[model samples]
Target: YRAFERKYRKNLKALYLVHPTNFIRLALQVFKPFVSAKFGRKVMYISDLSELNQHIRLDQLCIPNAVDEYDAQLLAKEKKPSAAASNAFQLNSTENGKALLETQQFGVSLAFIKENNGGEVIPPIMKTCLEYIS
Candidate 1:
């Protein structure tokens, strides 16, 4: 950021940061002196994914899986992961690179994935909260 601020700062218009950690916040504090008022006003800090959607849609960016992991924790804060939350769906693979099932559950539903031709059905209480699947 410091390097870019010195050279290409004028070329930039708006800047958005996602899930800024403590270290990033500290770095920005240190960098405040170097950034000019005009450019500094354009800098925006996005604390959550939904907030970022206002500026740029999720489809526009290829967000990493690690971001999702941080998201769950961010929402719950200090609460521990419940049993249902921990295993809403179990992922198995035909190959190491393969994902088992793609599910998009709206309202409420269950996900029953049978592997190796095994006759396993989901229990009545196995409702899922998954909104998207890929």
Candidate 2:
């Protein structure tokens, strides 16, 4: 990190960290005092892709598929309900509950997939398999 920083510090504009975990947060907090204030200011802890997209165009980056998958997982986790709410949902017998369940494929919403794919409904079989395995 030091060598890279030394070489590119002058040219670098910002260093964005997407989906920073708790360990990363703790490390940054511990090492922050050692780094220059200017360098510290340049470090941006991005919570999600949407936040990173605001600073730079995602098309320009050669992001890995795993990174995208991880970001999606993080987003899904954030949107997931509490244990009590999930139990309530499981017990629900209303048509609305069924409709809501249908809308969710894997962790991603069917509406989201349709919107991204020009109104086409894509089968989310992978999620069903994953759920079964878990």
Candidate 3:
């Protein structure tokens, strides 16, 4: 583990423990101190591949999982469409159409969050956005 750290030092941004086996989890825990000391607070644990993908940046080479409600909320907030612009452009201009298209693509890409049946509730606009992205 130290050797791995030495080789990848500073270049490592996040540590992903994917559905780790018990032994691996234990090993990870043992190395947690070292990792934290080396990488600071960038470690994140994820149970699903999609969650890992979404949380990690695109340039990091991980394909995102379908967006969840929380993810949708963040994306919606980040890419929220301006109501005034929506009315004026309405997919008519090339740029507006492209922006709308990108938002829609991201929305649909997150649709799977609706299927996960957790007790967590989702908002209507988020659902609509997910459908659009899909």
Clashes of each: 0, 0, 5
- Flag clash pairs in model 1: none
Go through the candidates in order and give the C-alpha RMSD of each one to the true structure: 14.9, 15.3, 15.7
Q: Whole-model lDDT for model 3 versus the true structure?
A: 0.58
**Which candidate, 1 or 3, has the higher lDDT?**
1
Task: Please provide, for model 3 over 2-71, each residue's C-alpha lDDT reduced to its tens digit, 9 standing for 90 to 100.
Answer: 4665658657777776545678767767977766565546556665555676876646674445434555
**What lDDT is reached at residue 53 by model 3?**
67
- Per-candidate TM-scores read 0.48, 0.57, 0.33
lDDT by residue for model 2 (1-134), tens: 47785668777789898888899989999999999898888889999898999999999999999999999998899898899888776655333334445545444465555666654454446456778899
Clashing pairs in 2: none
**Candidate order (TM-score):** 2, 1, 3
- lDDT tens digits, residue span 83-108, model 1: 76656534333234545444534222
Q: What is the Cα-based TM-score of model 2?
A: 0.57
